[model samples]
Target: MPRALLRPVWRTLPRRALVAAAAAGLLLAAVPRMQSGPPDPQLGLFALRAAALAFGLGLAFLLDDPARHLTTAVPVRRPVRIGLRVALVLPWAVLCWTTALLLVPAPARPPAGDLTLEAAATAVLALTAAALMTRRTLITEPGVMTSTWLLCTAAAAYLLLPHDRTLLVTPDDPRWQTTHTHWALLLAAATAVGLRACTDPVRARLRPRLSS
Candidate 1:
């Protein structure tokens, strides 16, 4: 049953769409660099990569619904189908992250040490998003999942990157003070809203009974 569902979901969106969108985002992000400004080119590239991840994830969620499309021909179990969908989506997320890391310029200063905190935070955020995608109930609310994922990723990026006192300029700076305070607040607010929608006890109680 799950296999049956998996086949169509995988085939629903063309690979071209994913690649095109990712590329377009990257190009747009590079615009800042093209102009003669002192913008953090690395940060702009990271933003592009983040956008790609969001786009790919959004496509996966949009196409994963069994109700909108037929699943009778598929031969996989529900759990298996969910697993397969997650497996498929995982690569896209990884690709986005890798692209962002690669495009962004390396730190100007010598490495202070391993970005352990940032790495751990990223791992946590990725796992959380993947878990949400695997759960049938969670995937239904794409907005919540997207918001949660973005918030977590942003937080992780802030914590993981090296901090130079000079580099800490704008709210967009990927350092401790600016990122930890401004971006954290934005992401936290988003996470709170997403969590409220997903885990609201009153809504959860009513949702299952109503659906039944």
Candidate 2:
């Protein structure tokens, strides 16, 4: 029965759309590199950021359900339905990130574990944001809303946040472990919030979209 329910849900998923967007980021990372010149870690770091940002942006669209109203009447629970979509996307996410890592030059690339953790946290944060917005505002078009907020938050974090040893890990940053610890905490908090967003509400709540 669950498998049967997923058929329609999977059909509506924007798998190709997300993959295409992520592929563009991978291209930015892989292409435009000087094959003959010396490896510049900064450029590699930029590529990594590009790929990570693109992946996170793609993830922001994961919770979007234009037909959500139609599904509200369906017998399946909302959390279950949302979980199915996430399950379907996990393999694709793995493939996309793996491809992105393989495309980068080994020498120029930051430590794979650290970069991967950052990517995971970013993706989770995107998911968390979408889930939060959906529960709070009940937007059918959460993608556009989440994407905008995510970019602004990211930009602010990078530009406005004061530089300290306890910041996000950069290419040559000495506080790699400390930064990743913060990332770990972030991942945990986001995951917890996302779960709460999926909980069954006391009332049948479907708030209007942000624009409304």
Candidate 3:
């Protein structure tokens, strides 16, 4: 990004949400080491799930800006502005995930690949919710509203499923493969929705009607 645009972009970032994201990473990274005894398998699973939820909550609010209305009116296109915001946060997200994974001892950490996929899906869904709320709902504060929805939806997906077809299956579980297929689909769909939300709304330019 150009230096001139950097200030404006940084000013528009959702600082509170970003802070929450960092805190989540810290918590995730620290939890495993805090336990005194040998690694507990159940605790490891719970930790991974907790991390995913926290990351999602943090990411869901990334688009929130109290000045969203004012920023929308700027000459810069909506996609450019939104993309800049997403780009700015991408590095932190990557770093946070990496740190969280590395902090957990190798034996205690959950299956890295599956857990990472779950985390990725959650993050994208959060972004999708934020984008939809920002552009579609036209809300002044988008994060809280969308974050609540994300949590509820995740809970529902887990509780509403049958015992044999759970969404939170462990890697060793028989349903693991199927569960991750759903996650992959979710990631793809959420990304498409976010992209659409970031795009500038098409303005219909009306032409003067001529008398026949």
Candidate 4:
């Protein structure tokens, strides 16, 4: 496939699709349980987090114009550009993943604290990955700053909802186990995607242009 189309096809679209799939899967998984009665707070939280993940990934894809470098005539430096790009994407990624971490229900049974140190480590890794990808993409196309801000705002609103709080640091409810597992999986996927996006060879060739 042409390099022009490769980014959207491989990186942007696929990531967006993956986010959608994850969200759908979570909702579907929770459906059967909902038939029993009102939706469990834990399950609701999982669904919301999954949706937020999808939105976050989508924002990254939208802000990144994979084809821009191909069209621009200016000769931009690669390293500086890449650094700025990383800086831009990082905040959104961190916001999304951290919010997700805060929103995911924790297990009741733990060795000591409410959340294990291992879990915190995992969360940090996930947040870092998400931030890297998002920053890189946004920095590549600063024109989308307004959109990025909107996304950030929306994510924050979702995270701050009353029900969302119940998901975080809630009592030891059995329903939370499933939600916790899904959160871990989501975090892992975000981390993997972030790493791949940052290391893509195409970025080296794109070069960075200084903001006006």
lDDT of 4 by residue, 41-98 (tens): 5554444434444444344343354555552333443333333444444464455444
Q: Extract clashing residue pairs from model 2.
A: none
What would the per-residue lDDT of candidate 2 be over residues 1-212, giving only the tens digit for each residue? 56888889888887765877688778877852655687777777778777888888888999888888788777677789889989999998888888888787888777888788888988989888988887777688698778788889888888888888334547667777888888888889889988888865546544433335
lDDT of each: 0.45, 0.80, 0.78, 0.43
- Per-residue accuracy of model 3 over 95-177 as CA lDDT, tens digit each: 88878887787778888888889899889888888887777766867888888998898788778978776778876788888
> What digit string (tens of lDDT, one per residue) describes model 1 on residues 1-212?
44455566687533654566557545644444455646564555445434544454344333235352234224343335444655676676467545544444443111212222232233334434543553435343343464456556555655765656232233344564554444344445544443433232455346657998
Using TM-score as the yardstick, the better of models 3 and 4 is 3
Off by over 4 Å in 1: 1-6, 14-21, 28-69, 72-75, 108-212
After superposition, candidate 4 runs with Cα above 4 Å error:
1-39, 70-83, 96-212
Residue 179 deviation, candidate 2, in Å?
Answer: 0.5
Model 2: how large is the Cα RMSD against the reference?
A: 4.4
* Model 1: how far residue 146 lies from native, Å: 6.7
**Candidate 4, run of 10 with poorest lDDT:** 108-117
Task: Record all residue pairs in model 1 with backbone atoms less than 3 Å apart, i.e. clashing.
Answer: 1-75, 1-76, 1-77, 2-76, 2-77, 3-76, 4-74, 4-75, 4-76, 118-160
| Candidate 2 stretches greater than 4 Å from native | 31-36, 205-212
Number of clashes found in candidate 3 = 0
Highest lDDT, which number?
Answer: 2
TM-score of each: 0.43, 0.90, 0.88, 0.31
